[model samples]
Target chain A: MEIPNVADKWTSGVNEVTIGATKDKGGSRQKTITVGGSKCIPFMDFEGNPGHKPVIAMDVYDIPPDDWTETLTRPFADVINDPAQWAKKCVEQYGADLICLKLDGIHPDKGNKSAEDAVKTVKSILAAVGVPLIIWGCEHDEKDNEVMPKVSQAARGENCLLGIVSQDNYKTLTATCLADGHSIITMAPVDINIGKQINILVSEMDFPLNRIVMFQSTGALGYGLEYSYSIQERERLAALTGDKMMSMPVICDVGHEAWRSKEAKSNDNDVPQWGPREERGPMWETITATSLLQSGVDIIRMNHPRSVAAVKKCIDRLY
Target chain B: MISIGERINGMFKDVREAIKNKDPKAVQELAIKQTEAGASFLDVNVGTATADPAGAMKWLIEVIQDTVKTPIAIDSQKFDIIKAGLSVIKNEVLINSSKGDPEELDKYMPLAKEYNASLICLTMDKCGIPQDVERRMEIAMKIVEKAVEHEYELSKVYIDPVLFPINVDQKQPALMFDIFNQIKMISDPPPHRNVGLSNFSQGTKEKRLLARIFLTMGISYGLDAAVMDVLDKDLMDAAITAEIIMNQHVYSDSYLTACRK
Candidate 1:
């Protein structure tokens, strides 16, 4: 496992820096976040206790879901109809470590929401959720940059991770995080090479490696999930073996992957032989999240209260 | 080509204990180990040890020089100890460092110049470590600036761009890489560029692997020298790769030679 060493190599990311400072260390929060600061790859407990286990963040969108699966929708009931209540329930009831508010409703064309509307939604979510937040942009690359800065700004001092800075609009999104002094999630589209490339590119911008969490772009079970898993495993192996640029802790956006799968969506009428759809749907997302946790993802972006609980159980067991 | 085995400093408890015991046997064993591990030079530092730092340096230098023919870096912050160390060692000497304290460098650089010994210069000065590339470069130039300013041979001065790990923030690693790269561009006939390997691996879970990997990556940009653990196989392998990449060893054969020898 020893790669031939190069004589003239360089190292980075020394003296682990804590991201979220608490009241004691000079911040508004109750506890500060500690990430990066690793001498080795993820979870080499033999190297030393990894310091902290990966954290879980539940997804509570700025707007409710229209096409989310039946099982996930059932729990929310009328709450799904209200974005603020949905977020509140996620924190108070679900015990989410952090709330990831997706401004999915602000897609400009898809949801047809205004840029101003998106920022207001962000501010409202921040006001509603007690825990630290993760602000997400809709898949629309251009509109995300247009809206992310507004959302990132509205949630300033909260030390949220902006999801995410992509290849196209990275300049703008990264600059916003840089200027605002917040963390960021740099994602690749189910490709290890792309993930490594973005990690290097973002680092070149001087955005702070400790703040940038590499996103391997998740996929649900039975839906090309193995591809994401392999990518994550490969990336982790490279990092542990000593690719400094790719060594940052990985974050998996499991909600997007888990929710969009056919296993989570199809009802019994569509597939009667598959058994009760209720447990099957949540189980599908849960299995996906659990699998990602084992694959060395230091944090997971997940949705569905039941799925979150199941994934947490798996994380506890794995860690 | 001078690989200064960077062990034998007081930071490690065992080495410190060995010093306290005045255990020349322990010192001799470590010397042979580093020499066999391909360290061309042995860096002996009595880091933070106030108790007879000079005496310990003399003891270590004599034992190491006696056990192996490799040169030594008489490394210490205190001047008397360094000179005390230099008086005993017979091989070519590299002044472990002379920067930060202008008074120290003013005294040490000329001694190094007069003795035909090499000097390691810290990029830092009295103002402290600069955060930006331009500032570190300015400091690096200042270190070299002093060498030429003090009439020391440019080649006699080695530049150590003090490297810090991106432990707290994942983003700082590349910033560090950028700083090292900027240091490389500061001059054509560059002062030898070396880094303290352990500084980057500090507080990391995979110290050995990361240390070697970081060194391997540094080769792409041109790190000419390093103060590193000569014992780690992974580190030795990394140095071999870097030697190949930087053409210190041509056609990849030199890797086998550097490592095997």
Candidate 2:
């Protein structure tokens, strides 16, 4: 199809502000990473607005522990006990471009690691990991809201995902993220209407959209993946074809579902012969992540080092 | 008055001679030219009264799709022809029409759902073209309801209170305007309003100019999008004005010019 001349529909990004002005530019860092300033979708320059292509951020966590698989859990075993050390290994050894710290173990109920403990952990990880970091809260909304503010405040200017802002619990999360001066992940279930509504809500609050990434929640492979794929495709098609409001580049969190699903993470006493666990596991992830990428997923939160490697290789292939 | 560009169909001898000669370079050039000229949709009906209408419609649809990306409103009464044309196109589909016939709509409107197609519902029924806007809206509403029932957006369905001659009676133009306004009021975001743009100027010397004036007025209301000629520059110029004046386009909309160029 001939690309329409109406390519430059809108622009939603801006040049990032450096946290501490360096000596040369007023802050202390040897260099500053400026993220966000795209006028178009990832590579759709024909559409006029040349959107900035999203960069990959590898997942890390504070207080790592027990449930690690041999292939994955084994590789990071040395530093799994420390948040700071683990983040360094992820960036130095695993080719991570950015580090995402999932503060899973600090939730009130889950980790019971107080907001103070969470803050200390965030600061330590930031020092240990040179790359820009993204922070994700544990599953419980209340605990996340309680703890994220402190984390955001501690990491002020370092720039991180204000964990998650969901449909039901966005108000507090949004305010915390806004107050602390961090970008946010605008999460939505795999539905276009709901996805768009959340963005509108976030926009209403006047948050800069370029810093906001739309996470179309992942559904496990062979488990309504097609439905999710279709929605993402339609959303992308609508945006690219000229719905200005919906043209924001999309984010897909494949790792969350790849590990959550039985097929991608299970070893077997119950399921059928799905082949060797190692190949089967990463295969499920790589394929799911790749499928979403093809359907216009600009950013992906991935797990499984091997799958991340594979997904990165593929991303390089396309771009 | 929905003005279907009755120019591209192979049923017309010049079009057939141009198309059958494998002259896509020309077929496409002409279609895009018409689309730019002012065709709301370049109607590509490729059939004669005796031919297999479906096959011809599909064939012509393929050619036009290859030539340009503008939505082509299928001009045919036969359901299968409309369906065939609907299937082959990649852009939005604007079915020229189906009047008061429920059975025909049942067999065909679903094709719209299958393809995300739009339509121009001719306001004729078992009785015939209603002489008034109220009745025109009544039939247009039926089409709207059926379209909604089939999961199509009302905005996608253009209700044509099909225009008659202004000379036979100048009342028809007013009736069309009333139909345009009435359909505009059908809902909060009323269904898009349009007409066979040429219908208002039937047999009139100022046929082309009249179509533009009617279209310019249609824009004053909440009318969005239209179907018209792709071969006439004057009409195309009117379209640019309609879009700009209606606030549909912000500043520079030269694609409207490029479509003709």
Candidate 3:
């Protein structure tokens, strides 16, 4: 007898979420990116429709990072201080599908920039890039609540994806995003229940579930990567089995987590066995990203053009 | 969770009046409301009040299909009434249902396969409703075996262990649950299971509450679908919570809203 086909009997699928609004849809983005809606595990072509191919968003910060390693900083060295020009380079030169603007300047311990400054950064990036934008807040709850509302309004009609709303502090951002017509991300600390709870809380505030993405905290390779990998896989399985609360597209912070590792950031002089420091950092990011992609991540926020290029090429081949 | 919304039946006062007056508006509104409330399928029944049951069934199917694309469950005991509704439906449908008796299966099984529709087979036969768990399992296995012998996809056959009113026999609910667990293992890839959920609350003082509580318990034991009131907020909330607690769904603070979405 011929081998019987073995595939999952998926009852439901991930929610399809569109990030930017085009002019016809009452936003200024030249193109909108859609993700999720997969009825099978990522890139299992023979099983079912893979729905949308995964995309990458290159990260640009409102204030230049003073501590970035030489390998990570070299590609955007010229535009480091300007958020708008930095965003332009990510889209034009690096071929980013989307630009993720991080409001690091608004962090109290960092520059303590005002909401107005955050809004200014948003408008400048919007002017510079035509692709969809994901506007991320600095990871402090009180500060994010203080500044995200203004940033949400600044990008209101443009339909940016704004967030980092945690379990403790989703109210202000959730309400503002609903009113401003942008999607938001719900964050959890690698705990699946907490991840689901955050989604439920935001949904209770009446933000449509399809307009939300999920962010389970990332743990880099050699830095509890297995924890991140398992949680993402669990979330995807839950989605395929018809759990709407866990069905939103997932976004991972590859640059933020992978670079934090000593293995990825240390100098060759300090750890020569790991090879050249230049190739080591991007390789760490590339490896971490490729692992998550198999576990069903919809979008990855990456740094280092070299790692971004390699990951993008991998995505093209798989999809 | 394949929720079959049960409000469009002509037994309801509003639906009876709508059928008598030949008004499609009331029936159409129920179809849209139930779809919004997360009904995977809407049960359309021309109740006992209709003088021309087949005509009413056809009209109900047309009105519902015109308003929404959600699938319909042609819910009538009479094969002719089911045929009337099936002739006009443009989308996938569920023939709800057949008994385990050979004659009944012989008639409806082929029609179900011919229309490429799914079916709900009751765990009862020409001998009548099975009182014990053993008889219920026997009838359920008979339905599955017949479906398989006919080359029908077992997945398309839904086995209902046949819920009974708590007021009639308080012991029946426990027996029903035991039969449900047994019925699931009747075949290799067992047929999906559901209940006419409202049957458990018949003649009860707090009818909705009784039905809601029983359905939640049944879900914990692996019930896959139900024909129930989707519009009852409390009942729907209980269903969502039960699925979450069972880990069939991930827990969310606003799980109630998420399930509807």
Candidate 4:
């Protein structure tokens, strides 16, 4: 008996977005990373061009994290106080493809850190790490508007990925990213329509569509992960079917969402049946990242070194 | 939706004057305007405006191509004029029609394949446009079968279930909608469904409203392409909004502008 061919052919592929710039391109990074140009869904490579491999971006914070569980903090405890060193450790030790610097301390309720503080932190990270950077905002719309613009200027020609601009408050960051020659991350609340809408809003500001990435808010394993998985799957399908509005590469916050789940964060004493906290947490993060990978996520924002290693191994084996 | 702008046809007064005077400005302006208004293809017809229609078609295509890069759909009942227009096209081409009759399909199918053009197969024959749904379906099925036998890419073949003026026959529009639904089931990944949109509103007082409403309804029943006035903003908006509602297009606040881009 002969095997039948059932491969599906698609008309369009997800847009290829390259983050970071090298000296020739007017940025100081050692290398640039490109993602999201798959003509087929996640791993059915026989169907069409598989494009580029998905990469991992480990998270670092400007200030020491106040609420991260011990399982999440143990690996990075040595350099947590210094943003630049933390970023260098993430890239050099754990083999992160990029560094995503979270400006958490700049939020008024967090520590009310100044724009100057944020800019200095951005500059230090750029100097310490040769890898590309993803500069995330503090999520407070008003404060992000004030601090991110200065931070964008601080890393002006580096071609970093600056983001988390939502539909309601994208203009400030969008203009800054455009002027600074950086790509942007448009966000929505896991609704595919709003996800597409935010991209349109950013695009209307005259920002180039190829320089944009999408973040549909993620849900961890055993939480609303199924919803995130399905939404990401739907987005990949939409991209394959030629919806230009939704065709940007997808980035999921796997570590943050996964660690927030009780299965990862709760004390082992509190839930003795759920196994040890150290192993449980990284497994949770790895499972979340790997599950979302099957739905065609292009960049994963992860936290734990063990989980990053596990997921990276899975990616290498699959490819 | 694949909007084939119906403005460049010589039946329109401005286009007729442009063709008569041999002035490229008016025709070129329409081409630019229609292309900017989100027309996927601009339909060109030298309708009764010139004794030398083949000559006029070649001229119109040259003039239009000078201004914009939108695909051209050579629209004429006479094969000679369509062939003439096809000869001058430098970009993508869509053959505006071939009758559902086997002989006509036999002629147009090879030409379409040779030019790598998308051919619109009208659900009509020598007996004229069918008034009943069953007759229209039979013709549509025949067109689909002929396309398959020709080994044409199904996606490139557009099946136009002919539409008549609502005033001439109110019952026909409803029947056409039924044909639109059944047309999808003709084959796997069925031929692109299309219609000559303005035909439904011809000779009616409420032309614009009827065209918009019928287009919105037809879209709900799976009409993917139309030869209509792209200049009519309301009609285009209605069509685009229907596409969004049907999840064919991803919606945003500025979707109307985005669709044009």
Candidate 5:
């Protein structure tokens, strides 16, 4: 008897979410990028096409970050203090698909920048780069509620992705994204039910679901990565099985979580067995990203140009 | 699981009375309840309720469409009644169903293709219901071949192994499951597999218990859809739990609510 094909029976697929709107599509960006739409598991091309290639969005901070490792800061030394130039260098020099502009300066204890400062950063980034932008908020809920509306207005009609709406504080950012005609990210703290609930809440505000991407808050390699990995896998499987709320493409914040681990930053002098400081940090980021990719992650937010290259190479071969 | 709600059939007393009196309220209520209960599709059958099956089916379709936008599975053994329901359905439709008999398929295949309706093909033919796994697979293969010959997308065909009453034939459920596993391997993106789930417990004392247990087992064995009573809360919970265990759903504290949403 001839061996029969064992094809996966997927009735639905990851929802394809397009970030940025080009000239004909009601935005000023030079290009737009779409991710998700995989009918099978990630990189399971033999079963079905993953549809869109996984993309890397280089992270850019709104203010100069003092806590970054020297290895991470070396590549952007000239543009570290300037958000626009920082975004430009990421796209033009490093071939980043999208620029993820984090509004960390708006935090109360950080730079304490006003909503005006946030808008200025958005305008400068729009001027510096023509590629799409993922305008993320600082984790401070009250600060995000106060400043994200202005940021959304300044980037109005640019079709930028403005986000990091948690289950408790999704209203302001979600409403602003809807009014400004931009996409937003819905987040959950590694809980699948809450992730789905947030999606329902956002969609109930009349925000188009196809424009929303999910962020099931990331965890570094030793810092609960298994929980994040399994949740991402379950989310993808739910999407493939026709669960509309869990069907949106997923984005994981790898840069912040990976670097936050002591294993990544500690050198032989700080913690004897971890290895060389320079390679340790980026290696942690790369390893963390590669693990999530297998779980069907659609967008990865990353730091360290070297780590980005490593993950991109893996994406190229797998896709 | 794609649940085709089985409450609107004329076999139910309320549905029979509704059809007899031409009272749309009873039919409309079932349509709304089933849709709210998370039924993927509503099955409408005029089962011995009226002498004019075609007319009753058209009226039933109109009432359900007016109440809810849920897609329909037009259940009838008669081609004319199926045609009547198809003509009036405003949303998605599923023709329930065609047999392996070439003549029956010849009459229904074109309607399915023209209406872009999904079809439920039974693993039975002019020779009647197959008693063994091999015979069920043989009939299923023929139905699939004919679907291909008619240029229908295999994705639109739902193959039913025609489950037998477990009370009468205790071995039938296992045989049907074995057939289900192999049938899914017959082609790339094989035809969707479904069953009349309640048939397993027909004429049994503990009907609900048998159905609930067997339905979960069938799902684990690769059944993708079913004609079922969606309002049975315990049965639905069992199905949801089975889906979670199968890794079909993301494990969440409130997965029961998540599945409905």
Candidate 6:
């Protein structure tokens, strides 16, 4: 008996989006990175076009990350205090395709860093690294509304990927990104409907659809990962069937979510039966990222150079 | 959903007058209006209003093509008329349609291949429209087999179960729904299921309401395309909402606007 073929024929593909800018494109970066444009589900190259290989954006904080576990912080200990040095270490040593600058310190409870301080940090990081940047807001709506526009202006012609406007508070960042020539990230919380709804809300402001990226707030390995996984899978299916609202490239905060889990951050004494903290932490982060990759995520915001290396190896073999 | 706007057919008053007078205004307006109303393909039929249907089809195709870039479905029972319309088309086209009988497939399938047009095949053979689910399923399987033999891409083939008016044969709609579910199993990446949606509510007092309800039900049964009124807001809303509920489209507060966009 002969075997039958059961390959799916998809009508559409995820929209391709490029971040960063080179000199001719008006940014100082040496190169830019593009993601999305998959005609099939991830790694199903035999069936159709699995457009670009998934890329990684390593996280760098606006202020030193005092809360990160020792295992997570050891890799960048020498440059931990300087945002620019930390970003450079990520790019030169770790092989990150992009640098995601999280403005966590600007929040009132964090450091209450001024708009000028945030701009200075963004400029220094851009000066230190040649790769394109992802400038994420501090997530305090009022503070983000105040400081992100100035930071957006500081990188105006560089064409960075600026983030994370949800349905209720998209106007400020959206208008600023529009003026700065940056792609915007639209976020929803583990809900596919709101994921698409935020994209619609952002695009309604005359921001082009192709310039948008989607982030469904991530859930770590043992923390509602299935919810995140299923939603990502559904979004990919929707994109394959030509739903424009759900077709933007997806980004997940693997590093942030993975580290937040107790299994990843606990001290050796805290989880003695779970094995050494070194291997356990990186494995948790790596497994979270690599698992989500199967659901067609285009860019993963990761931490820990070890997990990044492991996930990169996995991607290399699969693609 | 692939909506084939049914307003351009000569059986309608405006289209009949447009065909007789060779007036491009009425036909072009409907073409533009239907395109705005989200018709994926405009169905062009020079129904018995003209003495020379082939010439009328050619003229209609030219005018509609000039107005909008939406694909045209060359709709006519006569092979010669469909051929005339195909000759002048400037973009992608669909042949709507050929009967499920092998002889009809032998004639129309080659033309569809040559023109690179999607083909809609009705599941009614020379014995006529099947009244029972079993007979319709048999004819539908034959159509799929013939399509495979011809090496036609199954994704481009649309299998229509041939809906009859609910008032005329109340049982046929239920039978057609069963065929809709079964047709999907005939192939991987199954041939798109379509219907002449207005046919289900013909001559009814509540024409729009019946058509909308039936269309919503058909969508749940895996019907992906239809030949219906794109100009009817309520019907279009129901189709969009059904697709969202099916998870085919991602939902938003302005989903109706988003789907059309």
* TM-score winner: 4
Position B34, candidate 6: lDDT: 95
Per-prediction TM-score to the true structure, in the order listed: 0.56, 0.54, 0.88, 0.97, 0.77, 0.96
Q: What ranking emerges by TM-score with the best candidate at the front?
A: 4, 6, 3, 5, 1, 2
Best by DockQ: 6
| Worst lDDT 10-window in candidate 4 chain A | A2-11
lDDT for B205 (candidate 3): 96
TM-score of chain B of 4: 0.97
- Candidate 1 local lDDT, B70-162, one digit each (tens): 888888867788789878868688998877456667888888876778999886777886566677677777777677778887766777767
Candidate 3 clashing pairs, residues 3+ apart or interchain: A200-B254
Tens-digit lDDT track for model 4 on B66-108?
8999999999998888888888889989999999999999999
The deviation in Å at residue B200 for candidate 1 is 30
Query: Which residue pairs clash within candidate 5?
Result: none
**Taking the tens digit of each residue's C-alpha lDDT, what string does model 3 give over B151-221?**
88888899998888889888889887777687677776778888998878878899998988888898888
Which scores greater on DockQ, model 4 or model 6? 6
Tens digits of lDDT, candidate 4, A132-215: 999999999999999999999989899999998998999999999999999999999888878888898899899999999999
lDDT of candidate 3 over A94-196, digit per residue (tens): 9999999998889999999999999998998888889999999998889999999998888888778888898888999999999999999999988888898
What stretches of model 1 exceed 4 Å from their correct place?
A1-47, B1-261
Span of ten consecutive residues with least summed lDDT in model 5 chain B? B249-258
Q: Is candidate 3 or candidate 4 better by DockQ?
A: 4
- lDDT digits (tens) for residues A196-251 of candidate 1: 66766777788787788877677788877788888777666555444555667777
**lDDT digits (tens) for residues B169-191 of candidate 6:** 99788777778899888887689
lDDT of each: 0.72, 0.67, 0.89, 0.92, 0.89, 0.92
Instruction: Report residue B216 deviation for candidate 4 (angstroms).
Output: 0.9
Q: What is candidate 2's TM-score against the reference?
A: 0.54
Question: Candidate 3, residue A126: CA error in Å?
Answer: 3.5
| DockQ of predictions, in order shown | 0.03, 0.02, 0.56, 0.57, 0.34, 0.72
